[model samples]
Target: MPELLPQIAEPTDASLAASGRRVVEIEARALEHLATRIDGGGSNRTFSAACQLILASRGRVVATGMGKSGHIARKIAATLASTGTPAFYVHPGEAGHGDLGMITDADVVLALSYSGESDEILTLLPVLKRQGNAVIAMTGRPQSTLARESDVHLDVSVPAEACPLDLAPTSSTTATLAMGDALAVALLEARGFTADDFARSHPAGSLGRRLLLHITDVMHAGDDVPRVGLGATLSEALVEMSRKRLGMTAVVDDEDKLIGLFTDGDLRRTLDDAALDVRTAMIADVMTRGPKTIAADQLAVEAARLMETHKISGLVVVDEAGRAVGALNIHDLLRARVV
Candidate 1:
């Protein structure tokens, strides 16, 4: 018998690519399952109970979990806190050691465990119960001890794992995350939370600037505003501009109503004409008419947009009657982070 040639293994189709596609399909199915479960009659009571417990919370919602579930719990807690519902995350393992002190009768506990039987989380149930705190459990198994002990149980079960080995918490984790988001959004709507409220929670973020930053908040007021009265010489307007250090000045009428504006660019253009006398030429003769202006009550982001659209660096903020009340430049918006 001829000796069998040595068999060499070459790569076929990429298992990594196949695995990615499988993961997407599994997550999609898991999300669909979650949607169906939430809409089903059995989940209505649980959702309603959970909402009532959260709505009745006098203190914070303390979210706790272990391992991968812990990460999701932390994110859920953060979302709740930022969206007008006061909440924080506690580690289940640490609760037994010292973190249990953070829980009080006024607070509600939201515990997450895929198996609904994490020892660390289960161990804190009695303490929480004794403290008279309400417990809401998010788990895959409804019959598990954590679920049975909870005041409200939210089912986050999936059909199966995305992992072919069926040992990893893949689809189940996705389902849990989606459920948490749904809860946060529902609470947000029920509370009539507005964008201004959101801005208060995220004062340092871009959305805060867009929603909370008023033009007056970033505008130059009082003497810092470069201004020149009507009939003032172009030379005098330039002097006011230089003294104010704004590179420009508003030309206003006797009543302080803005009539026009003069800038360094106008100065350069006037200089090109030897016949234009700085001392004798009035600002009105060379000033640009109908210059762009913004209201003091307008949003700084809108001011920024006007500046960009007009290709100018500054704007005069006026009152409802069109009298200049303040001034602002690109630098102001930049400093306010409204740009």
Candidate 2:
């Protein structure tokens, strides 16, 4: 049997909510202060110089920190790596245990410490210097040992801690994180890093799908595409739509050029006229002439947008000369996560 749970005392709902709001308010102000510090509140030159150092480095930015600052350092490293700068997080605690071998002369070490005196991180400064690795310090105390010995120092000091006890690394950590983001984005812009460049690093993510997956990558081609000759009957078009399961068919002339589009919606309107026999009715008579078409190389997300804008469920992929070469339906975009 599972052990019985302990009955823990709970704080008042009102009190807990108030505390939550207070924490957010403190953290938000901390971030604001950081912005101010970067602009004119302190010395923005230090931050700019730090960015230049990393930008000029030929190797990865190796980040290390202790405690809560360590967690923030890991995230900062990831952001840098994903946004054009190559970086990795090295735990300061583990650095003394032979993990220091990961450091190379070409690498730049970015160390984080709220007090700027984390012994685990401070002890590595001599080794970093010995290996010719430049140090960039993210710290609340510029006068601290780590800051004084570093190549550049970023002041991430906050007005106060969000913790009621004023002991936990709360506001300072938040400030440090904001500073890290600022550094990464600054470098990204300096390097002309684009969303396409970011997408390449995250190919399996949604942004990558939106940017990298093209219409040709999802559209049906050749015989698999639903298409009908302009001279074909409505019934023949319906047969093509059924066989291809695209809910629509392109109407092409003898030159194999797309002249119009026919779909289930067109069939519904065609059925309204009881005087006409759909089996014998020509497709061009009821087709939508010069319907919206996308290029084979167009982004799948753009195709999805086109469908959304037109209240459409399918699209025909066309060649430069307006010849239909492929077709795709909403289902295809859905499967591709384009919708």
Candidate 3:
């Protein structure tokens, strides 16, 4: 039978909060020390060299580690991949069992072992070397075998772990992860990666919708657009607005060029003038002239900004020739998740 462990008493709320604060402080100190190291000296030079090597490589970065470090490596790989640096994680132990075939000579290897003595990682060093792949090691100990054998060493050392017992991989892992983020951001800047590039990689999210969606993609075009001739009465404009359900109708000239816009707000103002009848009031007289308009090629986010700036809910989408080609409102932006 297995031995039963003793039950420990729960601590007070004050003690729990204090413990949490201490852990955070320790981790924060580790990051501060890491920042200082990267600001100058051998570590700074090595970091620059590592980034250059990755940038020069034609293939992806192969990140590998053992145990807890392996989890951090996986996250680092994901960050690198999403930020324009091609990278993926492979288990060191699994690599020995034929996963090594996944690596190519053109690729760069990034190995993580905090203590620098993970046998699983060290065992693969010789084969990687023989394959002519450049290796970058991230370790707490510079003198460790893995650090000594690699082409570049990233020092992720911390003063100590955040664990009360000083045995868990707390502060070291935090520092290592931060270092990984530094590498990714550096490469991102070197490659001139922009928000548009990031959005392309994340097409399923809200950022993608805001960046990739254009005014034409969200606007109602052709017969669906609410439009009325400049000679039309207020009643005809209202009928067009009701038929298209866009809350506004564009007033166009004889040549089908945009002249003005008649919106719900215009109707409210027209109703206040009891002398003018809806049946006879010309749309050109009651409509708002020189209203805010967006081009079909503009980003949908621009439409949102225009609406917010003018305190309006809809816009007329026009072509380069000043013709009404489409229509959209705040509701279309809401449905497209651009707002």
Candidate number of the best lDDT: 3
Per-residue lDDT of candidate 3, residues 310-337 (tens digit): 9999999888899999999999999999
Q: Please list all clashing residue pairs in model 2, or write none if there are none.
A: none
**Model 1 scores what on Cα lDDT?**
0.88
**Model 2 residue 10 distance off true place after TM-score fit, in angstroms:** 5.8
Is 1 or 3 the stronger prediction by lDDT? 3
Error of 1 at 106 (Å): 1.7
Per-candidate local distance difference test: 0.88, 0.90, 0.93
Q: What lDDT does candidate 1 reach at residue 39? A: 45
Clashing residue pairs found in predicted model 1? none
Per-residue C-alpha lDDT of model 1 across residues 1-339, encoded as one tens digit per residue: 999999976645786688799999988998998887774785377876787789877889999999989999999999999888999999989989998888878999999998999999988998899889999999999999999999989999999999889998889888888888888888899899987798889877778778899888998999899999988988889889999887789999888899998887778898898988777898989999899999988778899999899899889988887788889888888888887
Error of 3 at 212 (Å): 4.1
Tens-digit per-residue lDDT, 54-76, candidate 2 = 98999999999988999999999
Where is model 1 more than 4 Å wrong at Cα?
Answer: 1-22, 39-45, 203-214, 229-251, 259-302, 305-313
The global Cα lDDT (0 to 1) of model 2 is 0.90
Clashes per candidate, residues 3 or more apart or on different chains: 0, 0, 0
- The count of residue-pair clashes in candidate 1 stands at 0
Output the better candidate (1/3) by TM-score. 3
Task: Indicate the TM-score of model 1.
Answer: 0.75
